[model samples]
Target: DRCRVTILHFNDVYNIEERPNTEPVGGAARFATAMGKYRDQNPLVFFSGDCLNPSMMSSITKGKQMVPILNSLKVKAAVYGNHDFDFGVDELEDVTMETKFPWLMSNVIDTLTDKPLADGLEKTVITWGTKKIGLIGLVEEEWLVTLATVDKDDLKYLDYVEEGRRLAKELKEEGVDLVIALTHMRWPNDVRLAEQVEEIDLILGGHDHDYDVKKVNGKYIVKSGTEFRNFTKVEVDFIGPKYEISTMKIEVTSAYREDVEMKKIVEEFTSLMSDKTATTLGRIESELDGRFATVRTQESALGNFLTDVMVAATQADLAILNSGTLRSDSVHSAGDFTIKDLLTILPLIDPLVVLEATGTQIIQALENGVSQYPKTEGRFPQVSGIMFGFDPEGPPGSRVDPNSVKVDGEYLVPEKVYRVCTKAYIARGKDGYDVFKDCKPLTDPDEGPILSTVIQNHFTAVDIVKGLKPCRSGHHQSLIHVASVAK
Candidate 1:
């Protein structure tokens, strides 16, 4: 008798509903169609995780929209990603209970009970004909501190390597023929795990949207990037006492047709959401157009306007924000700025925070912000008050000229204290603002709501374009010049 199993996998499908109107890409509908065709030959379908949360479409529906589609397509199992906890454990439980398939999370522990998630844990052993396949799931514990909002006072994160080794030992003792670790973690961490864990035969990974397959210490590690753009299909042929991987194929689902039923469900959900989000707020006198790189590199009319709003909202002496927070770069046409536009541009729930810091600390914070301009960092500050120039070619710490720094039309005074306004993310040292760690908050930390929502409410009827201007000069001039001239 010949035994075979096929594993169909996808990752980071953040509920993109329709086939992209502009670009050729896979949406949930197209993915369902592709999965249907694949299931005809083989039955197993798995997602590495990050299936829900994020995006206006999923948030509005409270993750109800994707449940019907996943059930129709028959996803066997999925590892839970950090984003799944965005709405907290209760909401996650609600979504899982509604899901037709089982949700897996081997690593995520409930702080209250001091145990792993109740829904799925350790491994799920499925006997396919004569072959017994073991599936284990792991979620990155860093999310407990980085992304999750639930009071983590009760939750404690465990060591992945130790837990993984223990779990593999247990599964091996259970007479499992093969082990598959469905890991929702960074690529580097997955690589490390594969090398360290000897019992693990294969790993289906997510997070850090990169697609590639590499073998570490005889273990196969595969990641199928982000946003449902690509999926991996692994065909396994099991011969008694031995196993062979016949084919590991990565397919682009955008080439296929949209799943009709899934598409219909998505359309209905999107329509209902549109009825609520499509209301016209106010007309823009002209287009508020800019890109993250374009606006941050120099001065952006939109950036300036947004920074001004933050300063006004907090009554801070200065304001700073990251251009990366602005997600979309599309040119807005002269028309009403709907809730859709606002949501697209600023999606994260980062609240505004006002802090009082000595002039020396503010300068230190500015230096730290500029230090992040390198390729890997995302928190480089875009300012509204002070100005300075940086030499990208210069080494770190030496990039910005201290002599050139200025605030409020004068050289930065180390002795003076300035009321600074920035997103709560930075105040908490999220995007690399260690200087803010010791700073005192001028206003209560909980006073303001998410800064993105505040901007939307404040500018409900205003033309943001009218207030657009470059916040910083592109020239390598002194901060004194930037403070005096840009203002």
Candidate 2:
């Protein structure tokens, strides 16, 4: 018998509507209509996750606004992305509970219950005609240490490879005709899974935000782009277990026909953000590069400017920031920087904190920050008051040379304590940076101004409203990847 089932997949979506309003793309209401037309293939609308937090709307409602939008699209199930944990466990659990679709997580487990984080997150099976297809979800194990807002004590992340094999074996034993591993990890990790697990037939992935379609080691792999701007339409020919895959991109030049049922819902949510988005702050002449690849992989001008703001806000001797804190990838042209821009980029609601630390602790922290360097992990450090050289070829924990560290134009005193400012997330020792956990607080996080307000205040007061280049000299300098040391 020949059966055809189309799988429609998207990942890392947050905005319900497209930006700029001129040639817009990415409205859930529009996406619903775009997806609704495929009635013949019994399309399974799937997402690879990361929609819930760091979004402008997530700030106001802790990701509650996403419920109606996702429900409108009739999403079958989603694998969790790292940003799914940005709002903390209770809020993530709340959003998980609110959605009509099931959220699947095969590797993420709740410690207290020794099970998947929420009821919606259990593994699922889909009946396609006469065949039963099993779906398994997995997140990168380092999420708990990297970007997750949950307490490390309350969660467990089993390695994805082992968990994937176990889950696939069980599903095959259950007589499912095919197995699809849905995941939100690096593309390389996805390839590793395909290499190890022969029972798995396909992997629809997210997290890198690029459009990729490949046949690796005879297993099919696909990743549609981010912002719901593109998706994969996969047709499975059941007679021979063969497949045809292609990517469909929704351009910004137009909008798809509105899904009338979800029109009012999107409008209402847009109304809630009207006042906030309309409020303008300062202006910039040049584009601020907040792209993940730019900030996470190298010294970005915006990253430097931001860490400088943090140092000023706290009056600390130095400051440290993680690249994941800034989310926007588009360069802001010469125009007003609105409250919306600030909130959109730094949407985690993470508070600033100042702590006292010795030079030895600082060196260890820097080593931890760059351990994932050249790989574009979230732990990459953006700094305000330090300059140092590092050897990327060095092993983990030995990359940063302690003697090369200097603070405020002076060499760091190993015995002397330096006042360092950073986010509450770091102070709590999140992201595998446990050194800050023991540092005594010089300024409480609650007493400090939020990230958005600090930047706004700085721009209005000190920044000249002219075409400007990124301020990466003092804050974001490390001599690696350069042809030679400049100094």
Candidate 3:
């Protein structure tokens, strides 16, 4: 006799609204309805994390808005994504407590607590159908270094392959029928785990937001799509000593009715927000590209627009911003732009600062920026008042071409000092920008203006010039000019 089980998995959801003008307009409401379609199958729900912040709603609530959304899914067990810690460990801990499931962090340990970081469970076991399923969470070392809120010294990261092998062996010895590794990492890392860990039966992964499935070494690695757009439905069948697996990608489209109960919960939080977010600020003549796949891998018009604004507002010679600062993950259409649209693109209150750095340091920073090229890492630079090119296939630290580097239309002189405008996050040396930590700050972070306000003021200035609002002068003219040119 054989047994069967079903699993529903998704990752990297940040918004709860139906993305206007986008197909499969997935929202929490519709996604909940889609999940219920598998109710009779008694499916086990699993999330690969990253639900806590970076959304317009999450920004206002410090991710509190995600609690009910996650709880609605009845997730069995989950792995933590790097963005989950954006608000710090304490906030994540508090948010997790309100949810109705366990989060796993099998490889990373909090040295202070002598336990999994964020108090996550190292492993969990559940009986489904006719067999016991054992689960463990794993992550990559790459993202651990980039977490701004966590102190690297307070935690320890274990190689996923090593941890997956050891943990799977333990689970098999304990008589579980299957061992599943829930991982929040890139595709290469997931493939590595599948190939190296013979005892693990399957890998459910996150971090990169693509719906994909691949088999390596007779094991399957699955990643559901992002933002409630799609989910992966997996089926496992056992026949004697051998088992087989199958998967389906379920799209959450308008064809499905919104789950009433979930819709109410989403509305409850949404109604708390002010209507001011809808106020029209300006019009876009061209679309702005903010998708991670685009901005993190190359220079984008949106990036240029933002960094230009930074340089103008701070009165710096050049500016560099990490691609991660743009979180909307969508292309903004050429039309009316509103406060809500602006917040969706940049939700965090990043303060601007001016740092004086030698041309050598600037080159080093650009090298570090492209170090994670083609992987969509946040360290990638989006710049203004400067231009440079790199070979994507070149060695990480040596990729940036020195001859291509320029500042204010002049080739960069290694010893020449230039004023660089950037957000305070990188100014403090986070996101692999180690060359910036020691740079002299021409303007202290505390004294600098908030990024969103500067952008809004630019719009206000434009509106003033258009005579749509009360006239304002002097301080905002430079930013308005920069923005107009970019537009």
Candidate 4:
């Protein structure tokens, strides 16, 4: 006799409301309605993680809004993405407690508790349609260092291929009919796992924000689109000892009606954001281009403005802010800049830190920033007191021209130490800036100002100077320089 089962998978969702005037207006409400159509198949829903922060709404809620949205999905299992731990392990654990499914972190372990990182399950088995299916979650090691709240030294991470092989073998030995690897990693790593791990019958992945499906070593690797845009519906037919699988990409567009309950849930969380949008920060004379296409590819006016604020706020000789820090993905026209616009540009409360980095380390960091040029990677640098040129055709480690490098209008001196103002994320060696890890923290995160707050303060200083708001005695006058530089 043959048995059939269905699987529903999606990943990297951030916003709950529909993106107005955008194609495939994939709101959580519409996504829920779309998934509801498959209920008759008794599909096992799986999520590849990253629903916790970075969205405009999540910025205010600190990801608390994701609890209800996740619970509504009735997810069977999930793997943790890098952004899931953005709030911290403890906060994630709390969010997990409220969710209805099991989260798996098969490779990462907490040395302090001697358990899976975030206390996630290492493996789980469930019976669906007369077959026993084994699930194991896996992630890449590259992003482990990037988790702001997680200390790499305090945790142990195993290779995904090794862990997938061992776990799938154990599950097969336990009499499971099929094994599936739920992974949060890039395409290459998933392909590597599919090739190396024979015991795993299928793989579902996340973290790349692309909708792709490929078969390697007779196993299928699937990645659903991000932000509730699309989902993968996999059909598995088990015939005695073998199984045949097929997948369909289902897009969530305006054609589908929103589920009332889900829409209400979304409205409840979003209504709280109304009051925070009206307070104007200041007026800009020209459009500040914060779109990813501009900021991640090359220096833009928005990048210069933000980096200028960083250098002014921390009084560092130079500043480097990752393009990823600017997330609005849209341009702000020359007009009244509001708190809403600032929050959209910088949703995360990134604390600034001053690092005493050598000129060599600075060069290394700049090289890393341009390593993935033209690919729109987040590691691209937006700078203020430094300038360097890179050849896109050059190799990654040698892209930046040493001769073009200058700090404070002078050529870089390899032996000289310069105070660099940057997000605490970079100081911890995130986004391929490992050269900064060993550098001394000239100013700790505690002593540094929050990035958004600094921008807001700069505007307040501008208002004070314009006599729009009365100034207090001894108000620092240094911030007014940022307004002038932006002009």
Better of 1 and 2 by TM-score: 1
Candidate 1 per-residue lDDT over residues 177-235, each given as its tens digit: 88888888877789888989888888888876767888788777888766666777888
TM-score computed on alpha carbons, candidate 1: 0.63
Kindly report which residue stretches of model 1 are placed more than 4 angstroms away from their true locations once superposed. Answer: 18-24, 276-361, 364-487
| Better structure of 1 and 3 per lDDT | 3
Query: Worst lDDT window (10 residues) for model 1?
Result: 471-480
Tens-place lDDT per residue, model 3, 1-487, is 6888899999988889888677789999999999999999999999997887556665456578888888888888899987787555766787888889899999998887788988899999999877999999999886764454455677888888898889889999999999998998888999988888899998999988878999999989999989999999999898886789999999998998999999998888898666557777788778889899999998887888788877766568999999999999999988888888888888887867789999999999999999998899989999998999999899989999999999988999999999999989999999999899989987656335557655655565566567786521112224435443443
Q: lDDT per residue, candidate 2, 338-424, as tens digits?
A: 767877687666767788999988888889889987998888888878887788999989998888899988998988999998898
lDDT of 4 at 305: 88
Better of 3 and 4 by TM-score: 4
Top-scoring candidate (lDDT): 4
Backbone clashes in candidate 1 total 6
lDDT accuracy of residue 78 in candidate 2: 90
lDDT of each: 0.67, 0.72, 0.83, 0.84
lDDT, residue 297, candidate 1: 60
Best by TM-score: 4
Per-model TM-score, in order, reads 0.63, 0.61, 0.64, 0.66
Q: How large is the C-alpha RMSD of every model relative to the true structure? A: 12.2, 14.4, 13.6, 11.7
Higher-scoring candidate on lDDT, 3 or 4: 4
For model 3, the superposed segments whose C-alpha errors exceed 4 Å read 275-487
